[model samples]
Target chain A: MELFTPDFGLIFWMFLSFAVLFFILWKFAWPAITKMIDQRAELIDKGVEYAQQARQDLDQAQAKAEEVMQEARRQQADILREADRVKTQIIEEARGEARQAAAKELDQAKLQIDQARKEAEQNIRDEVSAFALNIAQKVVRNQMSDTKAQTQLVDSLLDEIEKKN
Target chain B: MKRLTLIALLLISTLVSMSFPAAASTKGEDHGGEEKIDPKEIIFEHLGDRYGWEVPFCHHKSIPLPIIVFGSDGLHIFSSARVEHGKEYVDGGKIFRIAAEGDFKGKIVEIVDGEETRPFDISITKNVFALILTVIVVCLVLLPLRCYYRRKGYKAPRRWLGAVEALTAFIYDGVIKSTLKDKASKFAPYLLTVFYFIFVMNLMGLMVVFPGGANLTGNIAVTLVLAILTFLVTNIFGTKHYWKEIFWPDVPLWLKFPLPIMPIIEIFGVFTKPAALTVRLFANMMGGHMIVIVLTLLIFIFAQMGMAVAGGTAVISTMFSIFMLLIDVLVSFIQAYVFTMLSTIFISLAQENPHKEHGAAEAKH
Candidate 1:
């Protein structure tokens, strides 16, 4: 019964003090604490959002770098193929020039050979005709007196002509 | 080796010293005198409110508090020490004494014509001092939380203030926000204050020393006031729909019209919520403290058998009391949480959707 009984003095003081405490807490403390909490939550959310945005930007940069590298490699391959084609064309032109020069040289040598052959043939005919004319004159002068002596002289002249030729 | 021997000797001496309260009985019996110690008085004395603060291990030494009361003759103010030992104080030919028993037991009463009558006592009692101490502690803890938010803004506070922040967020988010939703912000201060107030009082009552053991929350008077505060918050801020639901509930006509049984039950339920709140907190804390005191009383009970038996029982009793005190700490937090949760639920019930009115009216058509 004593435990169940509530003293009026206690009730009076409790009511008074509790009411005062409630007023102070409601007016002063609560607003600031709750505001700070909400602010912190907002700040955290913003931080997470910014991090995600940064990661996305980094991914985009990486992809762009990969694309640039692929383009550069394609350009490099084009330049190498162009260089290879130019080298083959230059080599083909040089081979054609060399073949034309060799053909011209061969044709000039053939013309020189033909001229030398004609000149040699002309010199041979002149020498043979000169030797024939000289032998004929000697035979005619020596063999004027006797027929047997003229025949002998003519045969000797003929033998001399054969040796000279 | 020498230190080990010394340590063992110290342990034996401490255990022997711990058994002295039980050993005192035999010493009394050997002198051919039986000292009868009343366990009920010890338990109730510890639980009851006092005019003076009791000093530990000293029956006579106490801190006197101011006693203020209004008698039939007008207001009277004096020190409670004047009436400490059943002594009568005469002021202006009016005598006052602290009554020992009867209807006005443990109250400051005025003697007139040999009949004891209680004055209107507004004196600061032990429970009141504990209440003031609790209030001061709550302020000390809560004021810093507000300052941390004010000075540092959104950053978390360190140490004990950090614990306070977490507890506040827990009750705000877990209990109030979950139940009351948008109105959580409006009632946060009152609900949060009550939460800290009850928790501090419950924890302080668990302590066995001064400024700690006044049993403030365990006192029926204190819990009654707290419940009344919650009751006032619920009804005072109740929405129109809440009253409509109570008076003209959406049930069948026969229940509310002819019998009015539903309305009666609804009105009865409004009072019972606070009643349940009051009894639940008071009984849990009071029972915890009583159990610890009973376990300590076992030492005196077992002392009647023998000194060795009392020593053994004292060890067992101390162990159990420690265990009980540890469990009471958990119960303290749980009771505080439950009280705040129930208060939040009741407040939300009052703040039930204003949109319900349109739906109910439409349903009638």
Candidate 2:
């Protein structure tokens, strides 16, 4: 019976103490713990988001650098191609000028040679004509003494003319 | 490392076991003979409330507590030693004794006109003292967290405080938050407090020495009060739909008008949930205490046969008691966790949302 009977005083204390404990915990203890937990969770989430954002930004920057490098390489290739074209154009122009200069020099030499050859030919012709005239004068004085010698000279001259024709 | 910890745990429980014999011996000396080792009386004495604490390993010595009682005349305050060993102590011309026989046995009863009358007694019995100590301990352990959080501001707590946080979070995340969902924060304080409170008291009961061995959680009155509080919290915070479903369930209309069976069952269910909570915790702790007491009493019981049997039984009984104590510690944590888990589930049941039905339907596809 004693064990079966509920002790009222102890029950009162139990209720009182538990109520006080609950009130203390509800009003004081738990808010901070739960709040800090929430704050820590929130901070972790923010950190993860920041990391992902940074990774994305890094990827974008890397992609931009890759694009820039590609652009630079293309520009370098274009510059090299332009230089090769310019070098070929300059070589062609130099070859053309050298050929023109060589052609002009050859043309001047041919003209000078032609003029010298004409002057030499003219001198030879003048000398030959002068010698023939001197010979004709001498022959006329000697051949008048004899008619027979003059006819033979005329016939030989005609035969020479026929052979030249 | 694991094996080492187990060894160390067994060693510690052995130390706790040492006090069990000492306590039973002290009780054995009261009967003045080894043959009078009544297991029921010894176990009940250990499990039940007392006016004074039994000093460990000491005979005829108990730490007296303040005995405050409201008798027929008025209120009176005195030390428990005044009524020690069933001695009558006259206070304010009224005779009072720790009643040995009659209806109010093991309780302080007043002898008035040669009649035993129960007083409005609120003396700080062993259980009440232990309960107060538990409250203080809980307060001391938990109250500082508020300030610690205030100072730390989202940073992790230090050392043991971090361990404390882990335990709280386990219940919060594992039990309350999972069941309550978005409403977790609203109910976490009460639930968390209860978990820690019950856990601490359960652990305190395992030790047989001073400041322990109170058997507070095992007491029906205490568990009853705890259940009552849970009952109040559940119904008070119950949602509109919860009450509506209880009063007018979605069962057929004929069931409501003719029988009102659903509502009757629902109302009974509201009380049964807390009732089960009370019995579950009380019985588990009580049974655990009883088993260890019985196991230890085997030493004294077998001693009547012979020294050889007593020695062998002592060795075996000590080992089993140690094992049982270890199991009891685990059970202590489990019972606290279970109580909190059940309470959270119950509150969540009461907190059921009207929109969840649609969500449940949508989830199937």
Candidate 3:
């Protein structure tokens, strides 16, 4: 029974001692220890949060860069398509102009050839007439080297002229 | 591992055999019908509070402490050596003697003329000395820690500082943070003090080192005070909803209004919690100490019988004592953990918002 019994004086001393110890520790020891630990924990949490924010920022920048790159590619494709359209348009216009010029040149050449042929034919007709006239004169001269033929030709011409008159 | 085991086996067998011869030699000197060993006395003596620290395995006298007695007259102060192992001490009109074979047996009593009275003994007893030593040790350990933290600030703790820092962090993280949550920082200091105080006392009790063998935590009064403090801390800062949950729980109104049984039960629960805490710590430490002492006494009990019996039982009793001591070492740490863990839980429970929890439950339903 004595083994388990509690002494009043012992309890008092224990209480007083415990209270003193508790107060001393609570006031001094625990504050510094807990403060350091809390500061460290807060610092770590902040670091993790900063790292996560940085990662998110990097992802955003990467996505923005990708978007800009895509925009530039799209614009470049549009320019390339426009250039091809213009090239084809220019080529077609040039071909049409060349065809028109070629047709006009062909018409001019045909007209010139027709005029040259006509001139040559006229010249040939004049020469043939002149030659025929010379040949007739020669023949007349040769034949009318006989005056009678000449006189007869003239008289017949005169008689025909009188009859006509 | 194998070699170690073989060595241990050989050593044990040698000790066992050697004890037989030793017992035989002692037996030759013994007269017929030797008195039997009193295990109960030995165990009780080990567990009981003393005026001094007994240095085990030594023939020299125990280190005496101061004896302080507050009686009907006034305070009486003197060296415990004056009492001479509680035989008798006389000073003026006061008489002090060891009460034997009574309710106050093993206690120092005051004899006034013919009447016997127990003085209010607030002496520097073995347990008190140990507790004071523990406080000094705690301060010594924490002073260095406090300085290290002051110098280093937020840097990682190193060396002995690191070991202590780890223990502190473990308590903060495991007990305070887990239980107290938002209020963890507020209660951290108290929690740390409780943990270290209890743990140091328990470890000292197990080791039987300087201020170690004194079972301070095993004293019921000390534990009661500790529990009461926890009780006060919990109830004083208890939230409005904490009180509501106890008084008017989110149950049917009839239970609260008509019966009022729940509130009464809840009020009783408050005292029981701390009471349980007190008993749990005291019983565990006291029981562990008792078992170890009892196991040790078994060797002597057998030895008192005869040489053969003594030798045979020494090995078994010694083995049992060793085993019990090992368990005690583990128990000391465990009890410390349990006390701190429960304290944190109790304080946190008091701080809980019962209304919010009730609303959450209603939402779930």
Local distance difference test, per candidate?
A: 0.86, 0.85, 0.81
What DockQ do the predictions score, one after another?
Answer: 0.50, 0.49, 0.45
Writing each residue's lDDT as its tens digit, candidate 1 over B268-363 gives: 989999999999999999999999999888888777777777777777777678789999999999999999999998888888766756744453
Tell me how candidate 2 scores on lDDT. 0.85
Per-model chain A TM? 0.54, 0.53, 0.61
Largest TM-score belongs to which candidate?
2
Docking class of 3: acceptable
Each prediction's interface RMSD?
Answer: 1.0, 1.4, 1.3
Please list, in the order the candidates appear, how each scores on TM-score for chain B only: 0.91, 0.90, 0.89
Error of 3 at B281 (Å): 1.0
Give the backbone clash total of model 2.
0
Give stretches of model 3 more than 4 Å off.
Answer: A49-165, B9-33, B305-309, B359-365
- What ranges in model 1 sit over 4 Å off? A79-165, B1-17, B22-33, B354-365
lDDT, candidate 3, B107-210, per-residue tens: 67788767778888888888888888878788877768888878877789888999998888888888799777889988888778888889888888887555
Q: Locate the minimum summed-lDDT window of 10 residues in model 1 chain A.
A: A32-41
In Å, residue A120's CA in model 2 sits off its true spot by 16
**Model 2: CA > 4 A from native:** A1-4, A56-64, A90-165, B1-35, B357-365
For residues B14-77, could you state the per-residue lDDT of candidate 2 as single tens digits? 5544554556556767778664766778788888898999897664679999888999999999
